[model samples]
Target: MKTSSRLEKAIKKLYVAFHANELNPECCKHCAVGNILNNTDSWKHLSNDHGSLELNYVGKVHQTLGRKFNGYSPLELLQIEATFLKACGYQLPLHHKNKKPKSSADKEALFNGLTAVMEYLCKLDNINNIMDYSKLFEFENEKPKYQLPY
Candidate 1:
C-alpha cells in the first residue's frame, strides 16, 4: 500500500526517538517503519504526544526529517503494535460482508502475504517471532502466543 508522506515521516521520527535515547526502544518494541505501520499502539503513543505526526507529514516530503519526538509511554507503544497488526492484516470474520466465503486459494494468498510481511519485520527487529507470524494461519483459537498484558 502507498503510505502518505505524513505517515511515513511520523514513523521516521518515532524511529529516531528510539535511536537518540529520547524514546525507549523497548517501549516501541518493533521499531521498524513496517512494524510501526502494521502496529497501532506505537502510532497512538507517538501521535498522542507528537500530535498526528503522520498527518503533519502528509503534505511534505520530509515533515519529520530532522525533528525529535517525545511523550510516548511504554503502554502506548504496546497499544500501537496491536493496532498496527490489526490494520496490516489481522482478519476479522465479522467484517466479511459478502456471503461468499474466502476460497482456499484466496485464504492461502492472504495468509502468505501477511506472514511474509510480518516475517520480514520480525527479521529486521531480530525478534524470534517469525514462526508466530508464519504460523498465524494455523494458529489455533485465534489467540496470539506472546500476548502482552495491557
Candidate 2:
C-alpha cells in the first residue's frame, strides 16, 4: 500500500524524536533502506527456535494494530516497525542524510525509514506519560539502563 504524504511526515517526526533521544535508526531487511538502516547487533535474540524477540516484537505490533485495521495494513506495519526499533534503541542519526534519488522510489524509502522512527518515539512518549500501554507487548529489552525520560 502506498503511503500518503501525511504518513511520510509522521515517519520523519519519528526519526527526529529518536535523534533527539540519542538513538540511531534501524532498517528492515525487507525494505529498500534495509542496507543503510542499522542492523540488530546491539539487541539480543531471546531464542533461536522461537525466531527471536525482535520478530516477536514485530508480530505483536502487527497483531495489536491488525485488529484495528483487520490485518497488517502497510501504515500500521510500518508503525509497528518503528515501535520495535525505538524499543531496541534504533534511532535516526541527526547527521544522517536522506540520500533518496529524485523519484518515487526515494520517496518510499524516506517514508518507510521515517515512519518506523516516528512511531517508536510516539509510543515511548505515550508510555512515559502513562497514557498508553500500547507498546508494552512489543518491548523486548529492559527499561533504558541510564536514560531517563525527560
Candidate 3:
C-alpha cells in the first residue's frame, strides 16, 4: 500500500523511536506526537494544556491557514498525543496527580500506545489501519491466503 511521503516518514521515525526506547508519554518531546514532529516540543504551543484537543489562539490561526506540521494539523497533533497518553494509561491533562500507570516506561504499555497512535494516524490520513491483521486470517482452503511481507 502506498502512503504519503509525510506519513511514511512519520511512521518510520516512530517505529525507530519505539524500538530505541525513546518513546515516552511523560515528556512532551518524546511522546507520540512529539516524535511525529521530529522530537520537538513546539507542537505543545498549539494547545494551552497538554492532552487538550481544543486549540489555543496560535493553533487557531494555524488551523485557519490550513497549516500542517509534518502532514498533520495542530488539532490532529493534539488528538494524537491524547490518544497515545490515554492508551498508555495516563489521565487527561497529564498532571502529576492524575491517574497513571505504576511504570511509565512499561514496554507492554508503550507498545500498546504506539499501536493505538499508529492506527489513529492512519485514520487521519483516510487510509486502512496498518496495524490491522484481519487479512492474514483469510483462507480459501487449508493454505494461508496471504503471505506476510518480509
**Tell me, what's the RMSD of every candidate?**
15.6, 16.8, 1.2
Leading candidate by lDDT: 3
The 10-residue segment of model 3 with minimum total lDDT is: 1-10
Instruction: Give one digit per residue, the lDDT tens place, for model 1 in 1-150.
Output: 343444445446544543443332122333323234433333433333221223323223223443222322333333333333333343321133423224322333333433443444444345554337454444446766454447
Per-residue lDDT, model 2, residue 109, is 47
lDDT of each: 0.36, 0.36, 0.90
Model 3 alpha-carbon drift over 4 Å, by segment? none
Better of 2 and 3 by lDDT: 3
Better of 1 and 2 by TM-score: 1
lDDT of 3 by residue, 20-116 (tens): 9999898889989889888999999999988888999999999999999988888888999999999999899888889999988899899889889
Please tell me which predicted candidate would have the highest TM-score against the true structure. 3
Runs with alpha carbons beyond 4 Å of true place in candidate 1: 1-60, 63-105, 132-150
- Quick one: RMSD of model 3? 1.2
* Model 1 residue 55 distance off true place after TM-score fit, in angstroms: 18
Clashes of each: 13, 8, 0
Clashing pairs in 2: 11-114, 11-115, 14-117, 14-118, 23-91, 24-91, 25-91, 82-116
The estimated TM-scores of all candidates read 0.24, 0.21, 0.94
Cα displacement (Å) at residue 76, model 3: 0.7
